[model samples]
Target: MFKHLLPRMRERSAAANRPVSLSDMMEEFWREPFGNLSPLFRDAGYPAVDVSEADGVVTVKAELPGLDPKDVTISVENDALILRGEKRFEDEQKKDDYHRIERAYGSFSRVVPLPGKVKEAEAKARFEKGVLTVTLPRDAAEAVRNIPIEGA
Candidate 1:
């Protein structure tokens, strides 16, 4: 019954640079019943992120729909900015039955590499609407350092 999905599983595994077992493929296949309806419905990767730097500030924006600000955790560690969060799905089905759940839910973590050193203590984050924006001011000293030239 699921023989047709093997090729797709292999492609997905190869994209991630890892091997996918039959059980793992089955689990993912069952997780989304209407996954092939459209690209929007497919779990192509959650919380799509964009990182940009300008005017001595590094900004990271992530799309996190249906998630509260409290559900997210932002931190800078090891020269990278880490974002961790979860999207919980609550179905209060009293009479209507769910035909499809296109929204991918569960916990997710995204690590963005910093363009330069940032002042961790001065970082600021704000969650407005479904977008999460994190602003990190670059460390003036570390961002640009000059070394004296010694002639041999």
Candidate 2:
């Protein structure tokens, strides 16, 4: 039935290099077979993100071409860092229409969980040259705690 057909369909899709249908995209979002695949497909045009941790700071940088800083939003809830933004496509109406449209538009979000608790007040973010940089300072006490060993 569908179980056998799914693999063949996937292989056909790969061979054709066609974009997955919107319904299939929704299904993948719900199943989350590969974890965070939604964002990857939703914002396929955007460059990959870079995350780094050093000492007590965590840095995340993402490339968002043609996106304005005002359209981007960054927030922290609990131990998760959330980045949300929109990429608007310019409207063009001409006698000669476009044959193909590939760039993605609309809202995108990326939620990254911190390795340890962070100082929300100290978190800083900057955007320049179509790149967004978010810096989160790790809470010192939460970063590491000495556990006293006792003889049993």
Locate the minimum summed-lDDT window of 10 residues in model 1: 36-45
Question: Best by TM-score, which number?
Answer: 1
User: Model 2: per-residue lDDT, tens digit, 1-152?
Assistant: 56777666667666777635554556666776556557767555344578789988999888888888899888999798888888887776656578898888898987776787889999999989989898999998885777999998
Candidate 2 segments whose C-alpha is farther than 4 A from its true place: 1-47, 92-96, 146-152
Cα RMSD (angstroms) for every candidate in the order listed: 9.2, 9.1
lDDT of 1 by residue, 1-152 (tens): 98998778778887886557776556666986665478855644556888898999999999988899999999999889998988887876778788887878888988888987899999999999989999999999886767899999
